[model samples]
Target: MPPAQTTAAPPSPAARALPAARRSLAPDLARGVMLLVIAAAHAHLFALMATGTDATLFGTWDRIATGTMTLFADLRGYPMFAALFGYGMAQIHRRRSEQGREWPWTRKLLRRRGLWMIAFGAVHVALLFFGDILAVYGLLALVFVGALRLSDRALLGSAAAALLAASAFVFTITFAAGGVPQLPEKPQGLLGELALRLSMWPFMIILMTAATLFPFLIGIWAARRRLLERPEQHLPLLRRTAPAGIAVAVLGAIPQALIKTGVWTDVSAAVGAGAATLHQITGFAGGLGYAALIGLVAVRIAGRPGPIATALAALGQRSLTFYLLQSVAWAVLFASYGLDLRVSTAAGVAIGAAVWLVTVVLAELMRRADMRGPAERALRRLTYGTTAAHGRAD
Candidate 1:
């Protein structure tokens, strides 16, 4: 347990964030690869005014792409990241505790970071993307920081409760609504579009917070176990979870995939609602499965990581930058005021893949230059204030 002192500790001049050398490979690799999944998930949304995977038409390749993505990528990417976010928080706590900072000081630091993240998310939404998750995570830190002190049993129990609550809420909402809401007509200008996105941001925050809280809590539980950081010690658990969780995720996603691919058309509202809920609930498993799979990979490449692995870790380190860049790509490609490309789903996926590849290459270059991502640099400065350099430790 962290020290329970109510007073702040004297600030150490040398106190800093974890250095890159001390960082584990698995989380970075998971994040690097997860970006591809996230890209795949969002690419189609910008295809032709599609909000996300609601494409009305599909060719043969589109069907294949849609099926594969639904099985592996849809609703699967963010949960892993959410878990990583929680794990990161735990890491922060541990680091601060070791620095002789008690709970009060660490809590203040966390809330400070959370406030900055909320600011970052607001700008991200107003200027670039409507699907910003930074705000949701920030809000989580603000609200659930105390969860860090919960006992193991309490942590797991809370995770279970959050999962059930999310599932029930998803089912209830889908059942009541009966169908996906229609996309509003394109706004007249950039200002108008910004207004539309801002208007919806609050609701997205609520829904995403509910959906993500489960994984976030589970992530904290996993971190307490050091599951990702020391995968070699937990080989049996990782081996079992990778396959089983992925199997569940794929199997649960089938109904939704079939529905999307026109193979299970004319479905009743109840069936659709159930499928949606099932997809969401099982997606959590898929996310963890992907993380476990990455952990196994980390175990294998522990001593000698290849160029691909190296590049991926570099990208993961700068995931925030690339993520925002992706939003920029989407805005340029799909916005009514921009290219407004109405490409097919397959084409959009291709474009998304290309975008990811470009980011990978750029990330590799940045890594070689020993440079941090711009967004990360800015956030570090904001979060660490005058000690930003010592705080990040480059």
Candidate 2:
């Protein structure tokens, strides 16, 4: 008699989510560092809101912080995230394809994830913060998931068009208005605040989409080449991008920074608008350059990352959790019903850095314990199923 035979079960869809050891260090590291830049930028904006003046002009340290942030951090942070988001999208698609999943099914999965993210953004705005980017990226995913199937030339062409359109829109608006738009007044009560946030959310989504779409497309292009994933294979390109992109970003930022810091207060509207247009365009380079530079760092520390590198990578792996945590901190610290601390730009920056450091430590602890960030876990469950979500990385 022949012995009975049984077939092994197939791997779950969620199993395709990159495991910790197998995940690329560069993308995660860039994300962790980008959070710091985001924190500084937001902190500066909040400080400016409170002061009702350009916070950069407050003091020597404030001037230094603001200029540094504007040059390297301000518009830089979100674009990096946008590119990374595109990269992640491609990653998911690639994994699904390798698993023998068809394009239509994968497309549905991506859309489902995007819808959940939009829900998450709504909750975030209602309870914690107003400047929620999750929804913006969510909408991007919902709209552009098809781009994953696009040819490289098509992707690049679309990105270029989007970039030009965004640049033209910014230039036209600024030129017409003679300056950037002013921040809205902070509403009084919790209900009023919620209303204001919700009201502003749609407008923000539109603006952020325009600003982020180009990089998001560019990210898809990079992912197709496995740029970040296989940094060693593309050393020459990364090397060239790092310095050239940063240099362009810095030069483009100088005029805008000077104006904001009051050094060029008497400049005409045309000059101010032109400076803004240049900043907007160059910011894309800055963001990509930062990512490229981080990729080089990852190559140098490839096999054995030190303690700090390990911690930062951990935070990056669980970025959604830490990012939301930062929002909660901001709300508690500055909400009208909360402490409402209106510190200087320098102080705000210091506080933001401190908050980011605390997250780093917390993320390191979570890494040791082999715990997924609560938000990441939830998102995965929503995206895949309970079985697949059990042990997944973002």
Best by TM-score: 2
TM-score of each: 0.94, 0.95
lDDT of 2: 0.86
Q: What is the lDDT of candidate 1?
A: 0.85
Question: After superposition, which runs of candidate 2 have C-alpha atoms over 4 Å from their true positions?
Answer: 1-10
- Candidate 2 residues 1-394, lDDT tens each? 2122311333578666677988899999999999999887877777666666665358898888788877988898888999999999998888777666777878999999999999999999888777889998899999999999999889999999999999987787777777655667766678978898889888778878888899999999999889999999999999999999889899999998897777778767688778888888899999999999999999999999999999999999999999999988888877777787778887888888988999999999999999989999999998888976687774
Clash pairs of candidate 2?
Answer: none
Best model number under lDDT: 2
Question: Residue 151 of model 1: what lDDT?
Answer: 96
**How much lDDT does each candidate structure score?**
0.85, 0.86
Q: Output the TM-score of candidate 2.
A: 0.95
Query: For model 2, what is the error of residue 94's alpha carbon versus the real structure, in angstroms, after optimal superposition?
Result: 0.6
